[model samples]
Target: MLRTYFPLSFISTLILLISTCAYAEDHTDELHSATTQVTGFGTLGIAHSTTSQADIVRDLSQRSGVGASGRTSLALDSNFGLQLDQRINENTDAAIQLLARKADKDFVPELTWLYAAYTPNDRLKLRLGRVGFDAYMLADSRQVAYSYTWVRPPVDFFGSLIVSYFDGADAVLSFQDAQQGNYQVKLYAGFARGKSYTGHADYDFSLDGSRILGGHLAYQRGAWSARLGYSQLLVKNEYSSLVPVLDAFHTAPLATLIPDAAQLSAELGMQNKRIRYLSAGLVYDAGPLQVQAMFSQTSTNSLNFPDSYAAFLSASYRMGKWTPYATLSASRPVSAQIPLQPPANAPAELVQLYKDLNDGIHSQRNRQSTLSLGLRYDLSDASNLKLQIDRIHSREKFLVRKEAPDWNGQTMLLSASYNFVF
Candidate 1:
């Protein structure tokens, strides 16, 4: 299926490009007289991973390391983007970018961004169509080899779920001065509805959702730049199969080691469910050294589970040809309490069992921390190499089984990429 879809998608893109180019050619004189220009950029990479346990790292941009062989593989982290600019007048112009890449389960190129912008002046600009959310300038561009020092951004900080991009419309405003330098403020609001695949069987489900609003602000002067951003996601759960099981465990009786028929009857209950997240961060750069930190917290009011919060800090230094960096990240659940409610049909024994389990499980929350270090060497203007090592630790008082081993392992990655702009 992928093989068949790949060619068709490519052909369609080719046709669109030809049509756009032909249209531009028709107005060649006008375009040439205006500030019309076209440019392209891309990156290619390969990496390896070694883990003590069986784990698969699958995400939107790359999907390798699926088997339990604990081996390495080559990855084409390549992307091609086109920038078209046509000046309408001295003070106003039109601009748009079309980006394509191999993502998730599909190898065929898809439209990553297709937005038209109107920059009437230096202070303000309006954009509509597919837009990129400036979650974090560095984080957003982590997949680009030339954008950062690490072979990959810190997973502890970046995480698997939080780093994904969204498609929407955005507006940007700028302020600048000869002495003070420049600052950019961006406001992004969009709706994204798609399915994300995780390794877990029960967790994979449709992501038909919408985001009401979000934005970021950035300032750059001399050798330093700083940014701050905040965004919220309102997610609806489409998976209903797991609800019964979740509710069963959450409301089962707690008095007996094992619940009897009567107790089980008293425990069954129904409740509402919803998931929400809040994300924010800041970054700074000075000369060859840079520092960044970010924080994110998520909560589900309907679920009895506690809120989750994560934090990350990183610093990097440059030395002639090699630049080295280090990062630390940690996450833990927040505190929240609510009275246990059970369905009318639930048995008393079942309700007691659930209460016991909930009390035991709620006593301790999930906590994870990771430390990473890496170095990048600039091979040339169009190429670079990077090597990174990460040590990760996860602990959960309630979730850890007596027989199951705790999660403490190291992952080493070596990647090199060649990028070109034409």
Candidate 2:
């Protein structure tokens, strides 16, 4: 089967090696045969960073990081997942995947995907329940580390997208053309319930009722493929960390600094704000050469949240069972200007509050870029080993914990991982 923009179709990409075996069971009145498939993937990785000031994390949902937390850590890049697929009749099937990964400083098992797929015809398919968030090209299968060549996805491009799955539904429409190749369009809607760490241990929050809606179009022709996607998410809850800040806007010295404290407080609140994301990606795999590139833009209605642009380009060449790859990724904010600042002679506490507020406005101004080189060696048909090194440069805080007093905005990261599929 050819890959499409749907999660089920993505199994044909790199995880197609999941072979099915038959099993027998006794029935009292009748005898029947059914195919129940079990498949799993995992990565055991150790990563090291040169920086000892700020810590590095894979995504925003994680509470701990590598670097300052520890120069080398296994919890940073290590994860495991298992999936079960059951076929019911010819047109309907169900699948559920359980994944164990670090979130909120603990390795917790959670259902990453649980859906029943109905294929009414050859060209259409529908799914309901918890489905993978397909906002980017690789997002549908991002948890399956063995499906990709990189030891891990680039942090600069994927780190901030904390939501992995949404509980709702999706539909996929596919068409095939002899001359143009396969075309697929997918649309999805759901509400997310993902937890996020706010860099402070005491300031975690959940996206309980955030509504998400998105769609994508994908085109594949032989060894080349392309995808364009757009998504809009409306945040429905406020951060607990902001309660004090909002309260402060109505209090003594802070209220004296501005006449429109209420308005500024509203702008700083994340509740009920809609964020828009747009992305485009291209991939080519021909013979021994493979290339992938993606660019994305994100904007939010909240004045405190800065707009951002992120992009990455990767290429690899295969030689027998070994593959060598290189990647370049970057992310930058549209503006770094502070939304509001206090006067020079303001009280020290009020001045600090304004500075914190300004930092929140330009929080996305990391101006981060990274270059990575890696090698992957096939250990067997079901497993592979990878070694990679990345040089990261940033003008501000990258995807990391709060900065230390002497922290620099550059670091060299070394990683080693063994990825397996069973």
The candidate maximizing lDDT is: 2
Query: Model 2's lDDT to the true fold?
Result: 0.79
- The alpha-carbon deviation from the true structure for residue 66 of candidate 1, after best TM-score superposition, in angstroms, is 5.8
Tell me the deviation in Å of residue 45 in model 2: 0.6
Error of 2 at 415 (Å): 0.6
The CA lDDT at 55 in model 1 is 33
**Across residues 138-235, which tens digit of lDDT does each residue of candidate 1 receive?**
65565555666765565544443432445566778999877887888888767654554322222344544545367777778876666667665554
What is candidate 1's local distance difference test score? 0.54
Which stretches in model 2 have alpha-carbon errors above 4 Å?
Answer: 1-32, 178-180, 198-203, 250-257, 343-349
lDDT of each model, Cα atoms only? 0.54, 0.79
Which portions of model 1 miss their true places by more than 4 Å? 1-38, 56-70, 76-103, 160-167, 176-181, 197-202, 240-282, 300-306, 335-367, 396-422
Q: Summarize candidate 2's per-residue lDDT along 323-417 as a digit string, tens digits.
A: 99999999888776667867667788778878877765554454688999999999898999999999988666647776686776888999999
Q: Residue 409 error for model 1, in Å? A: 5.3
* Alpha-carbon shift of residue 130 in model 2 (angstroms): 0.6
